[model samples]
Target: MKKLILIIGLASAALTFNSCERDITSLNEDPKHPTVVPSGVLFASAEHALLDQVLSASVNRNITRFFTQQWAETVYVDESNYNMTARPIPRNHYNRMMASASAVINSPGVLSALRDARKFLEDEGVGAVKKNNNIAMIELVNVYAWANLVDTYGDIPYFGALKATAENPGNAEIPYDDAKTIYLDLIKRIDAAVAMINISEPGYSNDLIYKGDMDKWKKMGNSLKFRLAVTLADVEPALAKTYAEAAFNAGLFTDKSDNFGLQTFPSGLLSNPVYQDVIQSGRNDFLPSDVLVNFMNSKSDPRRDVWFTKVAGLYVGGSYGDENTFSDFSHFTNAISGENAQGFLLDYSEIMFLKTEAAARGFSVGGTATDLYSDAIKASMTEYGINDTTATAYIAANPFDAVNWKKSIGEQAWVAMFNKGFQAWNFTRRLDFPVFTNPAGSLVEGVPVRMFYSDQEYLLNATYVKAAAQKIGGDKVTTKIFWDKF
Candidate 1:
C-alpha cells in the first residue's frame, strides 16, 4: 500500500512539471514593448539624453556659466567659486554623451535610418521626400557633441569615440585624440552635412531641434562652423578664416525663426532641465550674479526683465564669491518657469554676434561690424519677446565703438547671451572681455582654462589619460585647451 501511494505522488509531480513547461516560449515575448525601437524614436532618445546632460545643474553644465559670471550660488558657493573637480564632472559628461551618441549609432545603418525615418513621416502624409536629409541632421548633432567635448577637454577620444564593435569590446576604452585634428575633422563633417540636406524636404516629424525643417538644420550646421572657426581664430588664423568664410557662404542663422533647439515640456520626464532645477527640485540654489545684473543695470539693458526674476518687486543679483540667502536675490525670469521654459543649444543671437566679430576681423561676412553688432543685440532682445521700439532705443543709446570693437562687441555679446553660460564663457575667454575677476581666495588661480579629466579616467584609462595630460601641460583646470589661445 505504501509503494502504491509513493508511485501516485511521483506521477502527480511529473504532471505539474509538464504543465509548467508547455509553451514557455510564448511567454518570453512582450507584445506591448519593442526589442528594437524605431529609428525616429531612437534619434529622439539621443536628443533628450544630450539635452539633459548639457542642461543639467551639475558641475558639468552650469559651472562654466559661473566661470563666465552669468550665475552665482547662494549656498553651494563651492561651484560658484570654481571648484568643478570636487565632483566627477568631466568623466560623467563624457560617459553620458558617449552613451547618447551610441544609442543613435547602434541602430543598424545609422545614416540610412535617418532616411527611413523621414520616409516613414512621408508615408504618414506629414513629411517631404528628401535624399539623406536625416543623415545630415544626425551628422550636425554629432558635430555639436564632439565640439563641446573638444572645447572642454583638450585631447579626447575622437576617431575611436563610437567605434566599439562586437569583435573588439576593448575599443570602448578609446584613446584620447588630438584636439586640433579633431576640430578639422569636425569642419569636414559639418560641410558634408550641409551638402547632404535637401531644402525641398519641407517638414519633419521626429525632429526635436528643428522640427524636421531641413533649412534650419542647414543654417545650424553652418552657424556652428562659424563658431568653431572663430574659436580657432587665435591658434590657427588661416584655418579659421577658411572655415569661417565657408560657414558664411553656407548661411548662418538669419533670425530667431531659423534657430534650432530643444523646447521645455510642461511636465513629466520631458520637462526642461533648468525648470527641473528651479521648480521640481525645490532647491533654492541659483542667483543672478552681481557681475551680470550690475552690468545690465548700468547699461539699462532692455533684456534684463526677460533674463531675470524679480525679488521684492525689484531686480537684484547675489554678490559673486559670497554666500547669500537665496530669497534675498533675484532668480531667472518666468520664461524659465517649469511650465514654459526652453533653452537653445545654439541661437540666432549668438550667430549674429559671431558675424559681428568675423566682420570686424575683415571676413567677407556681408555686413558692417556696427550693423551686425546692433542687429545681434536686437535679435537677442526680440528672442526674449522684448518690443522692437525698446530694442531700437537700446541700440541707438548704446552706440557701437569702432575703435574698441573688440571690447564693445565682446561686452554686448556677453550681455545678449545672458543664459548661455558656456557660449558666453567661450566668447569671454577668447576675446578677454567684460573683465571677469575672482576674489583673491577663489579655488582657481584665475579663470580656469580647461577642466581636469575625472578620477575615473585616471583609474581606468590611466595610461592614455596620463599621456594626454602630460602632452597638454598636466591635467589641471589652469591648462588651456589648444584652441583657447587667450
Candidate 2:
C-alpha cells in the first residue's frame, strides 16, 4: 500500500505542470551539478578529451593504427581490415567534436575564462602586445581542436558550428566547409596566433601542454602553421611555399623537447590512452603488424627493440588483416606502456621529414634532402634513446637515396613515427610512399583513405551531408580526402 502511494505520488507530481511563476525559484539549481565552472577548467577538459582522440587505439573505433599498419589486432579484425563504419568511430569523433570541442567555443565557462583573462590583463595596464599575446595563446588551443576535426573528417561544421541559439534560433543543422577552405583559414588563424605572441605577457598557468611557456606555445603555433603549409604542398605550391618559409622563419621544434604532446599522468582516469586501453583494461587485443615489424627487421632497425618486445628472440608480427597469438608476436615495449607515456601530437622528427620533402621540391626548407633526411632519422633515434654512435652508424648505412628521395624520405618518416598513427597515416596519404598491400583479402574493402560520415549526421542534415559525400567521391572508405592528392 505504501509503495502504491509513492508511485501515485510520483505520477501526480509528473503530471503537475509548474509555470515560471511557481517553479523558477531555487528548484533549478541542483547542488550536485554546478551551472558554472572555470574557463581554465573547461579548456583543460577539452585538452584532455583531444588527447583521447590522438592516443585512441581501440580496435572497434580507431582506424589510425590500422591506417599506419603499426599494430594489428589479434581478434576482431574489422578495424585492422579497414571496416571503420562497422563501429562507431566516426560518431564518437563527431560527438567529441560537437560537444567537447564545441564547448571551447560555445560554453559560458570558456567564454568567461577568455573574457576575464583579457579584462584582468587590461586592468593591469598590460599593453596591447601582452593582451594580443594572451588572446593568441587561447586561439592556438582553438586551432588545435579545429585541426583534429579537419584532418579526420575533411569537410565539417565551421562557419556556423556551435553558434548560440539566439544567433540562429532553433538551429537544427550547421553548414559545412571544405578541407581546402578550412586549411587556408587555419593557416591565417595560426599566422595571427604567432604574430600576437609577446613573450613578456604571462602565460596561462592552467595550460597543461606547455605549462604557460609562451615560447614553447609560440614554437607549437609556428610548427602547426608549417604542418598545414606542407599538407597543401601538392595542390597549392604557392601558399605552401609561403607558409613553409614563414613557419621556418617563425621557428619550429628544434629538438624532441619541443614536441607538442600530452604528458599523461600516472593516476586517475587521465592515464595515457594507449596505456589505459592496453594495460589497465587488461586486454591483449593488439600485436605488432607484420608490415611494421618486418620493415623494422629488414633493416635491423634498433627502434624495433625500443618499440616492441621480442617473442622467442624474434621480432615477429601478424600479417595485415590476420590474427596472431598474443604471445607469438612482439608486443609494444614499455615506451608506451606506462600511464606517464608521452602522447605526441606533433614531433621534431616529423618536422625534419617535412623539411626533407620540401627541399626535394626545391622549396628551400633549409638544406638538401639528404641533410634533412639524416637529421630526421637521428632525431627519431635520439627520441627513442638510441646512442649517438649507433645513430650515426645507422645513418651512414642508410644515406638518402638520391635516385628515389621521395620514397626514401616518405619511408623514413613512416618509420620515425612508430606510435603516432594519425600523423603516420596522414604522411603516408600525402607522400604515397612505402605503398602498403591491401589487408590480405580481408572480408571488407581496401584500406580506407577517409572515414564515412555517420548515418545519424546524414539523417540530421541529409542535404549538406550528402552534398559533402558527393563532393568527396561518394563517402566510401576508398575515397581520398582533400590534400590526399596522390
Candidate 3:
C-alpha cells in the first residue's frame, strides 16, 4: 500500500510539471514594457545627462559658480569655501561623463548612452545616409562630453574610456590620458563628425538640442570645434589658430536661433535644473554674489532686471562664502525662478564671445575684436528681451577696452554667463580676469584651478589614479588644467 501511494504521488507531480512546462516563456514576457529602448531615446538621455552636469548648481554635483564667485551660498557654505571631500562632486561629474553600458542602461551617462545608441543603429541596419547623420550627431556629443571632462579634471581616463565589451571584460581598469592630447584628438573627432553630416537628410528625431535639424547640428559641431580651438589658444597658438579659422569658415552659430538647448522644459519631474536648485527644492539656499552684483551695479547692466529681483528696491548680493539670510538679498527674477527657464549647452552669445576672444588673439575669425565684442553683448541683451537701442547705448557706455581686452572681455563674459557657470569659469580661468581671491574660511589656499579627481578612482583604479595624480603635479583644487596656462 505504501509503494502504491508513492507511485501515485510521483505521477501527480509529473502531471503538474508537464502542464506548466510547455512554452510558458510568452507568458513571462511583458508587452507593455520593452527591454530594448530606441536609439533616439538613448540619444535624448545622453543630452539630458550632459546638460545636468554643465547646468546644475547643486553643490554635490557642480560648484563652479561659487568657485568663480558668481553665486554665494546662503545656508550650507561648505561648497562655497571649496570643500571637495565633503561631497562626491568630482565623482558625480566623472561618472556622468563616462560610464559602462550596463551602468548606463540603468543610469545613462553621456558617452555610455551615445555608445549604446550607435550600437543600436548598427544592429537595426539603419540606412547609410541616415546612419551617417546619426553617427555625426553622436560623435559631436561624445567630443563635447570628452572635452568637458578634460576641462574639469586634467588627464582623465580617455583612451580606455567606455571600452568594456563582451570579449574583453577586463578593460574596465582604464589608464589615464594627457589632457592636451585628448583635446587635440577631440578637435579631430569634431572635424570628422562634421564631414560625416549630410545636412539634406534627417538625423536624430529625439534630439533635445536641434530636433532632427542637421543644419543646426552642423553649426553646433563647428561652434563646438571653435570653442575647443579657442580654449587651446594660450597653450597651442598655431594649432588653435588653424582649427579656429577652419571651424568659423565651415559654419558657426548665426544667432540665438542656432542656440543648443532645451529652452522650454515642462514643470514637475522634468523641471529645469536652475528652478530645481532655486525654487522647487523648497529651500532658499543661494544668492547672487557681491562680486557679480557689485560689478553689474557699477555698470548699471540692464539684464539685472531680467535676472534678479530687487531687495528693498535695490539689488543687494550676499557676500561670497559668508553665511547670509535668503530674503535679505536679491533673488532670481521670475524669468529664471519660474519652471520653464532656458537651459543651454551652447548659445550664440557664448560663440560670439569666443569669436571676440579669437579676434583679440589676432586669429582670423571674420570680425574685429571690438565689433565681435559689441555683437556678443547685443546677443546677451537680445536674449534677455532688452531692446536693440538699450543694447547699443549700453555698448556705447561700456566700450570694449582693447588695450586691456582680457579685463573687458572676461568681466563682460562673466556677467553674460550669469547662470551658465561652467563656461563662466572657463572664461575667467583662461582670461584671468575679475581677480578672484579665496573665499572666506576656504579649504584650500587659493581658488580651485581644477577639480580633484574622483575619490572612487583611488579605490578602484588605485595604480592608474596614483600615476595620473603624479603626472598632473598633484590632484589639488589649485592644480591648473593643461589649457589654463596663464
Specify the highest-TM-score model's number: 3
lDDT tens string, model 2, 453-485?
765677666778888888877877778778888
| Predictions in order: lDDT | 0.71, 0.71, 0.82
> Which residue pairs in candidate 3 collide?
none
Error of 3 at 457 (Å): 0.3
Taking all chains together, the TM-score of candidate 2 against the true structure is 0.87
RMSD of each: 11.1, 8.1, 10.4
> Candidate 1, overall lDDT?
0.71
Q: Which ten residues in a row have the lowest lDDT in candidate 2?
A: 15-24
Query: In candidate 3, which residue ranges exceed 4 Å CA deviation?
Result: 1-35, 100-106
Ranking by TM-score: 3, 2, 1
Q: For candidate 2, what is the lDDT?
A: 0.71
Worst 10 residues of 1 by lDDT: 100-109
Residue pairs clashing, model 1: none
User: Which scores greater on TM-score, model 2 or model 3?
Assistant: 3
